[model samples]
Target: MTSTVSSDLRERAEAVLATLAGPGARLREDQWTAIHALVAERRRALVVQRTGWGKSAVYFVATALLRADGAGPTVIVSPLLALMRNQIDAAARAGIHAATVNSANTGDWERTYAAVASGEVDVLLVSPERLNNPDFRDRVLPQLTATAGMLVVDEAHCVSDWGHDFRPDYRRLRTLISELPAGIPVLATTATANDRVVVDVTEQLGLASGEPLVLRGSLDRESLRLSVVRLATPAQRLGWLADHLDALPGAGIIYTLTIAAAEEVADFLRERGHPVASYTGKTDPQERLAAEADLLDNRVKALVATSALGMGFDKPDLGFVVHLGAPASPVAYYQQIGRAGRAVERAEVVLLPGREDRDIWAYFASLAFPPEPLVRQTLAVLGDDAMSTAAVETRVDLSRTRLEMLLKVLDSDGAVRRVKGGWVATGEEWVYDRERHQRIAEARRAEQQAMLDYIDTTGCRMQFLRRQLDDPASERCGRCDTCTTPAWSTDVDQDAAAAAQERINRPGVEVAPRKQWPSGMAELGVGASGRIPATELAEPGRVIGRLSDIGWGTRLRELVDGDDAPVPGDVLDACVRVLAGWGWEQRPVGVVGIGSRTRPHQLDHLARRIAEIGRLPLLGTLTPAGPRPEAHANSPQRLAALWSAFEPPAFPVPNAPVLLVDDVIDSGWTATVAARLLRRAGASAVLPFALAQRG
Candidate 1:
């Protein structure tokens, strides 16, 4: 039933495959089917296959054939920089030219854009964020969408709000899809979408003429041996990893839920003489690339990482994946584990679930979209002007991250638009989908409960995951710990446990000073912008621990969230240790406490104890000049509230640096404003110190 053109296209696709996957390479039936749907029938298709299933091959081969037929360059919307690099290399192997535009390649964007315009580039890879960028959406995207031969959405599940890793930036793809010329074949792909996500994405990828061709294969990977090792405490978990990490077959990833955990575990392992690297959102782009290369070449035993290393990274021989804490959703967990057991005969996948996992999940859940009233308030703030995100933050009560996400959703809904300067109202009627958001929130809670169930389940681990993914052919794998005998030892040496406890118990994290004044301060009636004057800025400060740390975090959280109480003896001792190890250029000559509206007694006690320990004079306190504002205001509003709230004493302090004590530091705005007041009050220098730092 195939046409002559279809047969010729398949032949050319096979030739491209040989170039990409070596002479022994032949397209899998599904791969050819996907390619034919894209090239021969010009139909939109959604391919949901497991990792190492030749999904990338289908796109590359189809791109080669389409370009040979004089079609414009294929455009791939990738999710990560690492994925773009891998795809570029894969394209070159198939004799297809490719270029990328992302945050890392700003300097070369113009050159790359010119190359694509001149038909020298056969494909263009871009991050989902680029779809919403002002210049790209207005200038470059129209041209690209007009002429693009094939449009590929890699990690397409992100386009669905119900997906585990939903990103507002990915929703902008809807606008791009709607703008693409008719008959320009579209392909969407993901490795970890459940039935719900699959249905959502299929609906989102609706074609102009007909429904998309959906090809979802089985989610099972026979090579992965799954197991869960539940330890009593965080230290035991760390000890278990130290005891057994090397025994796991080959170089792999140790996943953590937070950046603090990643750094903590990586440092612990390195101290024990393991050649490991930490990869997280805070890591430098160039450093991430080097770490990936090191893992690829087997130069490092493992890369301790956060979810930042998820999605697009590829390593065919990855031998294992160990989780320091369970992700909130089984779908996300499956995706992380998929990075292992790709090309190898077998790979070990272990989960070390923590008691703190649900708390972390709840914290993230709090950032979901606010009610309709808050959304309307934001829309009302941007009447006619294009205000920067920070400017919008000043007017809204939401955190910076949540506010930006809401704006992106609004933009996608046509209620607003992102222009070169900032964001502007589109003057279009927008209906807030309250029911949809509620459904999503409920779904997220269910997913969290499912993750907890997964940890406690005594049944087959792979089968539980398959059921969570709603796989129709879900079955128990005989390779798991439950199906077979336990494959991993859960013993933790006493010395290793002691070492982990000691390392975690050691406190004091440097709190970097705010260097720049937040933007649009003028609008908030504050006269500051750009860099903070060096004289007014607080010197680098210190916190006993982060609110997310494994050791001091729990204690700090209890102190901050519990009823008013004096600083505990252990925390005070830790503070003393922090002071002893401060290594400050100039020692504090006196202590001053910032007045706390809620925890005045706690701050007062902390300041008095520090003064007693150092044998220094207790300077007068900084009193609150006015009533407190809302607790969850954005940076600029917080700055505005604190600008004139602190009343410093008129008398000058001793001729040495002053330690400004507080119960907790959240925005650093209060500390900045307090330091400025003390500096103006004739203190030699101000050093802000806190018991805890909230991220």
Candidate 2:
């Protein structure tokens, strides 16, 4: 490109920018440079700007310029639905017609395609996952690839496996970029990418050995006042937030590491009269939309959210971002906190690091790339013919979630293809790179450690995060708690602590019976398939607490990790309270312990205590007939492991409802299988109870 700008092009681009932004808005120099590169030079560009840097403006402005020049429409590969909504709205502001084809809008895809074909849509937004959709790839993508004037990848860090928020599907974009005809400008944008990620993503742009026009800006946000409040306990952190959330700058987000935490925190806050809503991946679509709208319109003080609210959420004047727990990495933390101080003069960014943060991180890490045996087993099970994920689940002893994650990685590597009905091996020679996976694992640990370092650092918090991202211009931001006076209070009072303690300590998680049997169970020497007979199913059950809930979780985790012992005092009290709250229509007349060799004493104590409390008979332990099931084993494998593992208790079970007690219900399979045994032994109903549960 040239340092000299074309007068006419500048005038037209500025006009569109003004429309998309405000009348007083003008393009930043780097924004204009990116637009010039894409529109005038028709070159691939990678823009690594801050979150509120108007990255979308560059693409929307370039889209307008290209369309005005009689070029075909721009195709934007957006990652999130929330972002697509904002992008479509932004495009309309600039008089550009933007339509999206994502999983959320399946019914509108045909119309969207028709609009694109008719030259009515100026920009089309799609998810990276859509690129691999059999129909989208085999039919629609060809037309899009052949005619697209420009390709824009938003949240481009996802293209690199090293990125904090890497999605395997985003790696597939490299193929698209490679297949694009020459001179079709490609622009990739993200707010959080270190130097390594920058190099990886720039390569993904496929510039044919030429570097993409790399534009990286400092990641420091001047409007955010960063601070850390080191709370000693989950109850204290909850207490502090409940007491002080309203005193913050404005309506914003409260981020938690887990869905259960989000729900727990939100419920506690609402009880304290804060208009907070929970937002997680499992939230209903309409409810999520409502929560987003409430946050956007400032109808609620905050939305307790998980990473589901990570990208595409556009609220310019959001006043605060409070992390109930630290994110796993500095880059991810920066991206999440960027939701604040976007269009505000000042915003509060606070982190309340918890003791369980590392454990949560480890849990997520456990879900990473499966070991070589599991990977090879998955591939070996997949033949030329298509096999559904469920069928594969029965054949391989991997959980459904891990299987899907592994399949995506394989699909991205061209080892498997997701056809119409199921997945099929591509018959391609697939090599599992142990070194690469191990390196990524090590990188993840480093990121976690960096996040921990960020918590303990007395230096400028903003500078620490920026340095982690390799921002060259990182400096002491006078806005942070270290550079300036701390903006948030660290004191958590006795009353607030008591409240938070009760809120977290109070626990009840429903253990709904497993309904469906694992497919191909017959192959595993189990006759079960389709739905489990309702007659043999356990009645709805209760757990004293979840091991992932904020307060009781810590206590339960300690108990779960320690050597087998009798139930703790608080745990026994909690179970009693939970049993009282269960309100079962059929009161259990007997208590039976689930067979356990690892924690036999713990199980016996729980069963005996519950029987004593309920004034019921204590049936003998159900002796194990086989080995214990693997806790993390696949569903079918777990079921097979438990099959015939237990017989009826030595004592005759009365034909009344029986209280089946277990130490914990991690998978809920053991409880279900035990309950089935007792029922078949003559119990009318089985109400399974547990000391703790894993969320």
Candidate 3:
């Protein structure tokens, strides 16, 4: 690293930046330091800088400089599709050819692969998941690693289990790092890693020799004026947003904890005459892109979104970020609000802390890796043959998300490998680190408590966040709400509150009938396979509300938790309203109750009430032919447990559509089995209805 060489690399980096960020663009001191380490010294570096700190520029410029010196393409492992898209567009501006391989562009993969193979791509952006893709890992990844001039891990905090947003897919990068040629520069960048996360990520990216260069900047954002507005209820939060969304500066994002909440908020705001769109994990990719475009172009007031819209969305001039409910971790909150005020002088950051945040956090925490016995059972089942995730689910008791997460952890740990069709046990001995898992779980609980403290803290909000991130330089900022008089109004209009209440209170989500039987049912002695016959299938059903929903969720939880208490008057009335508004093709002519082992009286009362309201006959109950099985079994097991448990009514069933009443719908297997029996016993059609649907 001579003076002449250093000067030349600096000049080249500046030129790349000028192309990327206009003619007057210049790299900051830390950015230059990172570029110098990567290009001039060929050293590994971890940069923990704030958002909009030109992190992309450091890597893009290094890519340009390295490519000019006859090195291979720079390979970047990113965590998000939106980030990859943004990076590709940014690279093109800097005169660097960038292409991405992600789930959204499966058709273009071959063409992109060909371009990369021919050396037409200067920078290749790929998702961490792609690193574990059977085809990519077996083919492209090897070439990319062997010839890569520089490796960049964007959103590197995700590589650390301690990070707020940890994904097991990111752990696969360790294998990639180990396979890379010696002295090829590596850069890991993130805006959210705290001290623990930074330490963990650095260890994951450690070189065989000397320490990696770690660059950390201040975490404070002067442009963001943070505040918390405690809303007593979900409806009040929605009302506040509807009343004040237009008053916020320019266009922004309104984040919700759940997809249902996001949709509910967006719908409520739209009904109140705001031009808002919903963005969540369930939103179509094309629609998500459109919503992003709308927000960027200021076409919409805001996008009511979940964490699906959180990372890698680079809107420099984003005017505000309003959280309908606080995130479980302060680190996550900082990361989200970092999206705002990036290129502006001021931005509003508000949190509407709700009572349900802890409950939501607990639900997510339950998805962590199961005990050692379960893990060993899963591996023993895999044994030698590769099994698809769906096949594994039949033999395992975990939910789909939990099962996938466990498999990914196993794959990253080398105990299992994900191949073309499915995952297979590699017969590699794996030590279950019970202590480590417990520690992580405890850390998560601590983070949740920190979030609660954040909402209640009267000190400067920015300082509180900085301290949470382990920044020692955290000082009271005069820009936040506590440091100054409240800058925003807290008043919500009565009409808006009433409107929001009306929308949320209106329940009845369509319960889609299961089309296909669960795989591997034969192992359980069940002969069911392929698509369920149309005649035997239950018609599209209705539930008063999802257990995760805002309005009826609390009431439904109480009813389900109570000791077989009769349905409350208000809840019963709500069910009647759901029925009145249900737009089914045919009205149910009779009501049949599913004999509940736990809440038989409640189920009977619901059936009687529905019969009275619809003027339908009260068909006799379906009695259990055998003992009740375990309640929390997986779909196949549940179905097997209930297969012949329900006996057809003793009397003749009406030859008309029947309303099958139940207290709660957990797996929907109970409803499916009961409906099939009813349809077989001379009922024309069975429309399953439940007081609530468990998510």
Candidate 4:
């Protein structure tokens, strides 16, 4: 009964899909509809479906149909290297030649470009950052624009400011879309877009084609069983994981909010005889690949990870997802947990909500859009000539990461242009969108509140998450712990609790010293720059523990971030143990205290106790010469403020190693300056020791 044209289109599409799913495989009705809209109507579309809905298949199938109809190759702007890898592999299943150009494959770009020009590539994948790459934008982008048949924006929710994982680089896609020729099919797809995100992305990417195909489906998943274990302390959480991780259904992910937490948890679990790996932004690229493969093959229990492992990781039967600490928002939580329960009958999802979650959220919130004055200062620093990021950092007070992010935003807004060597002004008048930025910030706060509400809710957990995404059809999921019998244990055994507490109570964190001076020190009136002289550098230092470590972290945070107090007896005892275990090349001959303004009692207690216990002479303390260094500054600015701020000890210097002590080591620059002074004053070596380090 199918019309001839429609029947022929389906025939061709089914043939192409057969390669991916094998013989007798078929596309869902929605997938077929999306492909039809792109291939037959040549119209733009926004497909907001859940993860594991085969969104990639739509673009791959559309590309096959379009290419056979003599259209130019398709271009896909994907967000992650893992996503691009999966896409290329998927494309090959359908017999389409796929190539990618991203930060990882820079060495093969020339060859890939030649292949694209020679019509040997059917689909090309690229990261959003590459859209603004000077060479790619100047040399190859124009050619692709003129000949491109279709454009695919994967993880399309990132295009909207309302998205939980909003990225500044994704904003550059606006310029890319503006340059594409008319009637070229554009498909923007994501599994995480909420109502606001969908509308925002629709306006940006599909509105030009007049109300392009908008296909949104339900966000609820039937296969996920959600629950939360309200642990009151870090030890209890670690204890519970150690006792119950092996009982989880299959290889899955354990998400943490910070890199330190990820590494800490991974180490703890491994020591408990669970095979696991830590995956975070700090993990090397090749190691990340290996970890992903191990997880895919179920070679390990889980990959303890931060959000770096989120999105586009295709493990169809991933059996579980456990969060050590709650993410700041329910939307982000949902996106992460969505990786599980995709192709399985049921998957376990657990949240071990901790007291430290909100503190972490506030820390990130403090880094929102800078004030108007800073924005103007940044703009004023740019002109016709390209200035390298390092040069810009010399003038701006922002950190290296913040500066790079600001430049990307400016480039997306047309206020600056990235060229060879660096960035230059575009002569376009830029207005600070304070109102919009404020709204986005407020939205973030609301989402964070929603996360708290989700944890406290007595209703269906999956339904609560779906409602946050504005899913109109969100209904009480019958499989959650709140709705059904619990599947995961909530108890922590005595031995497990003791073991976790024991490990955390043991503290010895090596504090790595700053070996090189920051650039542009002259601008800050500090003459020193480049590498610090080895003779003046402090030997690798030691801290009792990091403020982010498991056991001592919370207490250290209270001592440093709160009002001053004398060092606790137990903490001092732990410090003694740290000294006992410190494998120093040369023992200390004397002790010197770096004068403290806020925590004098604590600082002096630590230094005096170390000196008395070690039976060493207490050299004179270095007194403050000027004002306290500014807080929350770049390396150069921090160095500028600290340089010469500490007066050299007035007492005669002994030409031997001395233990330099401080209450808290936040930037490490203070210690560097202190060490350089001690060495210049004729000391043989300086070894820095601190109560805690602020990450």
Q: Tens digits of per-residue lDDT for model 1 on 92-167?
A: 9989999999998899999999999999999999998898898887889999999999999999999888998888
Candidate 3: regions farther than 4 A off:
207-209
What would the per-residue lDDT of candidate 2 be over residues 8-78, giving only the tens digit for each residue? 79999999989988899999999988998899889888899988999999999999999989999999999
Tens-digit per-residue lDDT, 574-626, candidate 3: 88888888887888877888887878888888888888877888977989887
List clashing residue pairs in candidate 3.
none
What C-alpha RMSD separates each model from the true structure?
Answer: 1.5, 1.8, 1.4, 1.6
Estimate, for each residue in 1-695, the C-alpha lDDT of model 4 and write its tens digit. 45789889998999888998789889989999999999988888989888988898899989999999899999999989988898888899999999999998889999999999999999999888898888998899999988999999999888787888877888887777878888888899988878788889887664545668988888888888899988889999999998999889999999998888898889898999999999999999999999999999999999999999998999999999999999998989989999998889989999999888888888888777677888788889989988888878878888888888888888888899899989999889999999999999999999989999999999988888888888865467898888988777678999999989988888888888999988767876779988999989988899888887767888888878776777878888888999999988888899999998777777887788889988988887889888776675678887888887898789877898899999888889999999999999999999999989876
TM-score of each: 0.98, 0.97, 0.98, 0.97
Supply candidate 1's per-residue lDDT for 191.
91
- For candidate 2, what is the lDDT? 0.88
Top-scoring candidate (lDDT): 1
- The parts of candidate 4 lying over 4 Å away from their true place are 206-208
Each prediction's Cα lDDT score? 0.89, 0.88, 0.88, 0.88
Number of backbone-clashing residue pairs for each candidate, in the order shown: 0, 0, 0, 0
**What's the distance in Å from true for residue 90, model 2?**
1.3
TM-score of 4: 0.97
TM-score comparison, 2 vs 3, better candidate: 3
In Å, residue 164's CA in model 2 sits off its true spot by 0.9
